[model samples]
Target: MRTREFLLQELHDLSQGIQGPFPYDDLRKMRETKRLTSHFKMLGDDDQLSADLNTYFMAIHGLASRLLTGNAEDAPTTAIHWLARGDFFAIFPMYCFLEDEWEQFPQFAHMYGSTKKMQEIVLSLLLTEDEL
Candidate 1:
């Protein structure tokens, strides 16, 4: 796993890079198949920053799906991937918000219970940040 400083620097570098009308078709396909490893592998380590951005994209997609559908099933499996990927560097806020709304998602109560430690880590991360 990357350090927080390294991940933050990568996010900053990605923010400075050329903005794209990026090709989403391949990514969308990979997402549908739940082939996240394949998707990340396609983005070689030479492009680590893009890989990081892709993880954030997945997290946002997860959050948006949950908010729109009000169903935990609608949440991206990638949410777990992002949680495992650097102690919730980019996905912390979304996870925290989702936890707050978890009461509306009784089906996910057991799963959420398993994630309590991650949620705590996310809270700590958020508290440590100068601004969220």
Candidate 2:
């Protein structure tokens, strides 16, 4: 498994190019998001940090994938709908970590490592604009 700091670095690198909403609609079609949510559900209590990292990566990877779209009607907006379910509550994992008093994300500490950062690195897939 990658270290926590490595995942943080990945997220920091990811947030650099995002200017608006995350592309989670594309993520709804990605294998990675499915894997992320599945792994999230299977986590044990001791793996809260792992869960946090997974959520961050899920969102960031999605955003990075959409950076080149060059069009809006192509992907007008984004949402967290894929992770929300009637069967469960879907808190962004970093906020949940903070509520548990877990340390804030080192790379995102300026926002106390929450909220705005969540908006920064939201989810989509690797598909190019032409593919979408």
Candidate 3:
């Protein structure tokens, strides 16, 4: 099993993309994301959300495997492949806040200077169908 350090490094790589900046030491985010991995693992793969989560987890796991085995291969997945899947990095603030226990997403614009698309994504995740 991959350790917490490996998981955190994956998240850091995802958020930073092309190695923009070394992520700050955020142990809380690491723990929360680990918990999320466990929770998402229980869901059926048929669900879209479940599938996306599985894809993401698998992508990171693959990257971790490559790193641990001294096989530093650069395949397309997550923020490392920023040119191909750049949106993942663009919307990374959501994960930052999710790690912070879900802040008022409406202020994502003010806080992170996020755009309409990002706001809608956050709203869709946070609000119910009736609210939308």
Candidate 4:
């Protein structure tokens, strides 16, 4: 697991990159953003989880900005709506972990570890694993 400090830092950096208020006051605020939680934050912390979630959020946030400003590229912007739903489901595993669904992710001791890695694995599982 990454340390708590690292996770906080990454989130802080992510928030800074956002054009609007970041939804999270802390990671816990994800709870109020049900779709985000369900789709993204359930895995134990790891590099993959952190990277995947960051990428996902960056994509979402960028699309949101484009939509709000009327500057979106037609194809990418059009695709956001289609991807949004699956993005939520892809994020569910990590969200579960953040919510203290410990049994849901047994490999990591805490979320502070490699969050990006964890997210990546969960995303792969959610996206590619037919049985899931």
Q: Write the per-residue lDDT of candidate 2 for residues 1-132, one digit (tens) a residue.
A: 654345445555545534344333332332144434554355545445434545644543454344434322344244344422111123544224234322222332333244344343332232333533
**Backbone clashes under 3 angstroms, per model:** 0, 2, 0, 38
By lDDT, who's the top model here? Answer: 4
TM-score of 4: 0.34
Candidate 3: C-alpha lDDT: 0.37
Model 2 spans with C-alpha error above 4 angstroms: 1-14, 17-48, 71-79, 83-97, 100-132
lDDT of 1 by residue, 17-83 (tens): 4234333443344334443544435645533433544555445334433433445444444454445
Ranking by TM-score: 4, 2, 3, 1
Each candidate structure's TM-score, on Cα atoms with residue i matched to residue i, is 0.26, 0.31, 0.29, 0.34
Please list the residue runs of candidate 4 whose C-alpha ends up more than 4 Å from where it truly belongs after superposition: 1-47, 73-82, 86-89, 92-95, 99-132
Which of 3 and 4 is the better model by TM-score? 4
- Cα lDDT tens digits, model 4, 1-132, are 654445345544443443343323344444345655554444435425445545665555454444334464452633344343453335544444454442233332223233333333333322334522
Clashing pairs in 3: none
Pitting candidate 2 against candidate 3, the one with the higher TM-score is 2
- Report the lDDT of model 3 for residue 61: 41
Q: What is the C-alpha lDDT of each candidate?
A: 0.40, 0.38, 0.37, 0.41
What TM-score number comes out for model 2? 0.31
lDDT winner between 1 and 3, please give it: 1
Better of 2 and 3 by lDDT: 2
Q: Among all windows of ten consecutive residues in candidate 4, which has the lowest summed lDDT?
A: 103-112
lDDT of 1 at 26: 37
Worst 10 residues of 3 by lDDT: 18-27
